[model samples]
Target: MNLGIVGQAVGLFAVTNIDDVVVLALFFAQGAGRRHAARNITVGQYVGFAAIVAVAVTAAFGATFLPERVVPYLGLLPLAIGVRAAVRVWRHRGRGGQEEDERTGPGGPRLLEVAAVTFANGGDNIGVYVPVFATAGIVGMSSYVVVFLALLALWIAAGRYFATRPVVARALSRWGHLLLPMVLIGIGVVILVDGGAFGL
Candidate 1:
């Protein structure tokens, strides 16, 4: 593994996934105290990321899986999720603990749900990774993959740390249900606009 390649991989992954920290933190906040919440989020993140990497690697090999214009359609996943969340909150308003209960209900956060969100949030990552991976030869690709996986663990730890901080946890516990939907919606909108979907 060339040190230069390692450094480049680290920098690229960090730049692409910086926003994931906040998103993961929000997930942890909502999943706190629920059974298997952390595990679900972690596994989901890895699964989603693995999918993105698979796509990028495939594209790098001369097989295009997604056209640029279609990337923005991915935003619909998060937008629908956010809308569903908002509707749930609205429907349960004034139910006195029911809302929170539903939000953090028995299943915790579903692994697939988390995975979908992670993947949806990673359109930019795919765009960035495809070119980088394409330029990296076999050896360099291996190094990049290893480094990216390692950094993903670090990102998870950081998110967990933030979610567990007393002040942040308190605020999130109180408002996470509401904030999460809004954040998801906002992320969707940003993706749509950034990708020029629907002409911004």
Candidate 2:
């Protein structure tokens, strides 16, 4: 149980997940008027992140069938999601704000939907996690999981705090429709480039 390894795990997770905070903040703002918004997001994030950890740990073990190059293509999931969101916003612009609000109501974003987006957004983490888990023994991996889960709670709180702020929430509500999709697309491109999927 090296403290250094724990520190490294925390650092790596925090650094890679910094962008998630922004995304999560937008989710919070989107669902601000919804009941169980925080709970839904918390559950969704855990489910989504658990899938990521499962994949990374499995790869760390003996499942080397999936190539490192192919992992980058997973970015397409988020890219598609972003494009869909952008289209929805565009269509809603012609329909009117009330229609959009009714469609995406207080109970709009379901747990599975958020989970899907979170999983998609988190696809890039596989690259970092696989290499880290390869070197980490069972205890080290366990430590990483514990630290990550704890930090995840903090991350949720931060997003909720931002969403609760009147000015911040209003700003996000106003501009998030335009920005979130672009951000997701950008994340996908970064993942693809970083992974050198097409040798580019």
Candidate 3:
């Protein structure tokens, strides 16, 4: 109900998730024309984001589901995923008629994969959200959560739109598989550096 709270929620979500747009786009590109791709992505995004919010809310309420010291290690999730993707790409390269392998390999961006990546990418979000939720009263927090969920649909739509664009779609179709590993690896490295995970 408070305009201030609504604005803050919007800003925070945008700032934290702008990168997610690109990631989601890549996923859409990879999933283009595949059965259940959109549904898997949508469900995965919600599941992943919901986990992040739950962690933040729990921490705000004084529960340490994940200790602060352990937060940085969360980067391992993405890092491992990226490495695995890269390895798969390498192994399957030049193996023609492997479209099915490409699609079904490692389960092909299914709900669990997307959810894991989303959750992994959201480590920083939890850090940002915990303090905000702590300060926000129950009403404010609820508003923020509602706005976040609603905007999530918009984010998915935006990603799909970008992926469907003529030029972007072509590029993604050609290079999406390649780009995926790089992006995931890059995200993992950034999270690790930002969280000082390596030092720990």
Provide the TM-score for each candidate, comma-separated.
0.94, 0.84, 0.93
Q: Which whole-number lDDT from 0 to 100 does residue 160 have in model 1?
A: 90
Which candidate number maximizes lDDT? 3
Pairs with steric clashes in candidate 1: none
What is the lDDT for 112 in model 2? 74
* Global lDDT of each candidate: 0.87, 0.78, 0.88
Residue range with the least summed lDDT across 10 consecutive positions in model 2: 100-109
The candidate scoring highest on TM-score is: 1
Selected candidate, larger TM-score, 1 vs 2:
1
Which residue pairs collide in model 3, if any? none
RMSD of candidates 1 onward, in order: 1.6, 2.6, 2.1
lDDT of 2 at 47: 92
Task: Assess the local accuracy of residue 198 in candidate 1 as a C-alpha lDDT between 0 and 100.
Answer: 91
Candidate 1 vs 3: which has more TM-score: 1
How well is each residue in 74-127 modelled by candidate 3, as lDDT tens digits?
Answer: 778878888988998898788856764556434457898889889989977898
Whole-structure CA lDDT of model 1: 0.87
Tell me the tens digit of each residue's lDDT in model 1 across 77-179: 8898889888977986789776556555555567987888888899778888988888888888888999999999999999999999999999888788788
